[model samples]
Target: MKNYFDFILPTPVLFGPGMAERLPTELRRRGLARALVVTDRGVREAGILNPLLAGLDAAGVTCCVWDGVVSNPDADSVREGIEVAKRNRPDALVAVGGGSTLDTAKAIAGCLAAGVAEVFALREVKDPRASLPVFCLPTTSGTGSEVSYWVVITDRRTHEKVSIGDPALSPTLAVVDPLLTLSLPPRLTLWTGLDALTHAVEAFLSTAASSLSDLLVKEAITLVVKSLSCAVDVGDNLEARGDMALASLLAGAAMQHVGLGLVHAMSHQVGGFYDVHHGLANAILLPHVLKFNAPECPDKMKTLDNLVEGEGFMEWLKRLYEKYALSGEKVEIKEEDIPTMAERARANVNAQTNPRKAEVQDIMELYRKSFKVVE
Candidate 1:
């Protein structure tokens, strides 16, 4: 085991129907008092924080909320959050929202620990120094930022999404409470669920896949396959929501362990270029990239095909997009941008994990094929 592989799940998790209510107690256990809450507008406006805040109040924990986090958290957004962090001087951080909000909170915590003014500074370093304690409450079950050791922070100046991988970025504690996600509407439900599916599929296909990650990814995929449709179609169903939350967490851990593939690399470039939702771009790219990588990992693809009820893995991925109505959204991307995006994707370290080594022209072809394919 020593020479073969190393696996670590650094965060302690508290999972249940109302686990977010346990936050104040958990913070106190960590010897924390004043807290900075990093979140997005949806969590606040949807009234998801009322009960959690009431619990914090009852536990005598004070907080300052920074709810300006945007989708695809950029350097400017994180810097703004850090300013809030500096003001509050909170002893701990509570990240409450979806993937973007959770990532914002993690970067804010990392910036405070590293003594850095901008998240981009931390991005340039191989292993950032700051490792702040973070309590994560995932209102969306998609990105799995709650349990992962990596984050994608966009540089505002260039609009390029920089992927940062460091163990220091993992949350100190993760609270997966399905009740908090009851407020997640159907569109978000579809996007995030598909994102979780992509995470599982990518990790399972990664060349770095180990016996340990394979087990985790398989279970994660099973959960998504069984629960995503139920969770999307019936948002308030506690059982389905709980399964998806677990699936996202497991898929995240698996991805963090084995790394991802060309899908994330290609889609991230598009997301940065077109300002498309990360998951939406991933949903569009998953089947195409998988088809490209399938030849290199036919045995793994066959395993996945057997697990999922479909004609083939490719058909299964297509059905997932169609089933969730993910194909209808217009991409609005310029054809001229395809080559640049492909070059950027090839340069991205994420593309290295593809079972098949992706060529520059291969990615270009993929990007061109993806443009205006919806009908």
Candidate 2:
């Protein structure tokens, strides 16, 4: 519990069932004429972009598509997006996909604004400039990239996950419409819902947590506890989907202010090294990290336990895992990789805010537990 903290919700959000259709109106109201729609191929292939594109056209905003973003986006993808931006010369960036697409758009916008040639170079630049007014429409309810100020990109050369945190990376606006998430598969719904829960839990337990963040994360955790299963079990449950969308938004908002913990620290390394889904990695490691941190924040854990109906926080989390069959995922990790990953996890930015200080050995053990490896 920090005695002092600053809360930020810099990006204005439009949230509802049909808020995505209002994106063009938001852009036009901002006087954004030429826009580059940044997204992934899967989103484009799903025809999710069709209505939005039509809306942009009807609004007379010239749109160019950059559908090159991939999962766990890397520096190379950002560079490619930069090239597209250069060619299109858009005044605004409209990111219309999941976390990866949103993150890539932010990187491209930040790099271009800072006049940097590479994405990571923005990290070294003095007085980083604000991104080019990014408008995010998230197709998934996790990662909260729609409201977060940080961008995680894999370093292709080092094979290490790096996060660039600056207010400049925050999107200018977020349109969170649960209808967009209706098409999300059950597995993703489960993973992303768990990711939101992890974000709320980690933020609530963060050393930097403030009164505002505590409120936000507590509500977020509660929403996930109540609605995540219904959302996963019945993907078309609009009410459940809406609750999850709000939960993700609130969790993202809270974590951006208070920061995360060992779950994200270890998960970032896993995603960077293994190209695993970020949400999936977080989901797998969250319960183990919570257990490790419980001693440091017993009261907070108890509060969370209450939020999940007092089933015991860890036990409830384990039940959620079992319900989703998360332990059965065919993720592999070599014994030799543990040391390197532990080192990176220790050095990760998210580790600094962990309520419990995790040494390299602690991280290694947690990784083993997540993978069920014989130690």
Candidate 3:
């Protein structure tokens, strides 16, 4: 944590029950006319995009839709999105869906901004900017891709889910309407909410944490602890949904400044190799990572324990995870693959900010511990 650190959250957020209906106004305010809507089939099929799309049309914003984004978005999907953008010539990209859709939009924006053909290539650019404004309307309360200047896309060949962080990748506007998440199924609700909780926990424990980030993540943690269960079990509880939505956004902003820790570092690789749901992987790995780091950062661990009113942070987290986790669910990782995954985890961008240093062997041990939990 540096006493002399900078914080940046240039993206303005519109948050409320009916905020999704205001995206077109936001686009028009920014002088954006033609739009390319990025999303996945699930969001579109769920009719979550209807209100936003209707608003855009009513506002006379010409639109084209690309519902090609997939879970754990890959570089190939990004290339396909770029092709769609080239043909559409839109003035803005409007993302309507979960984190994957939001992240895919940013990846497309980065590629187009850099005039590159591939998403991964944009990583090497010294300064990458989106050619057009990117608007985000999150349908999930996790990943925080709407406000964060980070995009995680998996590489097919390398099996590494890479994180691309650049200030310009931040969305020009984010419309976080919790009502959109009401239709999320129980399984997704649990996983995504856990993802938000992981974000707060990792950001709070990050070595790069500043006073401001610590304050934000603390509130975020409290909200998740209070709201995640109701949001998951009840699904239609508006207040619970709103709290989780706010928690995700707050944690996303905090992590943007301070980065994250080993939970994210390890989860990224697990998702990359196994196509595991990112949040589920993080939920499974978080307690294990906490155990690994508790000795190094007892005060921070204690802070979390106190915040959640647990006898111990590890016990609290485990109970929360087990409550929603699939019975007998196991990580789709093999012992033979641990070496490669551990290596990838060691190199993950999130690893750098971890309070406790993790060598390859230590990461392998964490993986083993997490993996054997089901076995």
Candidate 4:
């Protein structure tokens, strides 16, 4: 336990079926009229966009759609979004996709509100003022961007992910309805659940882990362990999806309170450079990284180990990927790039809080170890 700490989870959240139906009420509560709906093309095609539009329409609310977002969202895309915001100047934003959409919407809203010239500019300023309110209905159970106060915007030119975190960036309201996640394919379901698992596990082992964060982490881990497979298999099961949704929110809240460590520190670089799915990168890298950090957090590791049926938490993590059909997705890692990747990962904001301090060499080793997976 640290003598001093700062803890804040600022998002107001509602979880259940048809929560999106009440989205108009949330907007009305804030006296928001003109709204911007930020989402991707896929969500638009999935027929998800229509209901939100209908809900807003039912309340006589008008919205503009910025549906050009891409999968590994880049800073350039966010800059474009900021331009759109500049033109419409909507009073509120509704993020309606996965992590990428939510993250891009957050940066665009922040930059537009603060009148920052660049999306990256919000990163350097200590005090960020968000002018417009944000409401989110997550279509995916992972990323937790709907609840957390940080966004990862990848730079197209540099192939580096920029993490911008501030209290002003938190969504004013988050509504999660498991019905929204019913259409997710198995691959996405697997990766996102694994991502939630990694978040809880890593936050538990972080040096900043507090009594409050621990309670959430433990529950989050248990929920993921119990409900993830059912959600993936059934895809449309309400109970499983609801449990995973709650688990993801808890894990996101835990990471917000205590922060994450080596797993995310390393995965962010890989996800940025390779354009791989963020959760998949974290799942592939997690076992090796946690095993390396295990000695520094024996008791916590014991707790994690107990979550699995038998011994070896590391083995259980590896088996999880296999069980979920997540192990076969391949990411190409060049031997020459390891040095640069290691340096960047070592520079991650959360690297210092890793239970065991890691050096550049250790990051390189972890990457090399994760280059291939066996089923």
How good is model 2 by TM-score? 0.97
Which candidate wins on TM-score? 2
TM-score for each predicted model, relative to the true structure:
0.95, 0.97, 0.96, 0.95
- How do the candidates rank by TM-score, highest first? 2, 3, 4, 1
Model 3 global lDDT (CA atoms, 0 to 1): 0.88
Backbone clash pairs for candidate 4 read none
In order of lDDT, best first, we have 2, 3, 4, 1
State the local distance difference test value for candidate 2.
0.89
Candidate 3 per-residue C-alpha lDDT over 1-375 given as tens digits, one digit per residue, 9 for 90 to 100: 556689889899999998888888888988889999999999889988787788899999999999999999998899999999999999999998999999999989889989999888987999888888898989999989899889989997988888888898999999999999999998898889889988998898888898899999999999988888899889999999999999999999998998888889888888887798988888888777888888988888888889876366667666766676642146657878888889888988889999899999999988888864322
Alpha carbon lDDT of each predicted model: 0.83, 0.89, 0.88, 0.85
lDDT of 4 by residue, 1-375 (tens): 553667777998998988889998889877888899999998889999898798898897899999978888887788888888888879998999998998888888788778886888887777788788888788998888899889998887887888989999998888988889999998899889888888898888888888888888899988987888899899989999999999888999889878899989888888777788998898888888888998888888888888877666677666767776555247777777788889999999878779999899989888888875222
In model 2, how large is the Cα lDDT of residue 90? 95
Q: Which segments of model 3 are wrong by more than 4 Å?
A: 326-329, 372-375
Off by over 4 Å in 2: 372-375
What's each prediction's clash count? 0, 0, 0, 0
Question: How many clashes (backbone atoms < 3 Å, residues ≥3 apart in a chain or on different chains) does model 4 have?
Answer: 0
Q: After superposition, how far is residue 264 of candidate 3 from its true place, in Å?
A: 1.2
TM-score-best of 2 and 3? 2
Residue 127 lDDT (model 2): 77
Q: How close is candidate 1 to the true structure, as a TM-score?
A: 0.95
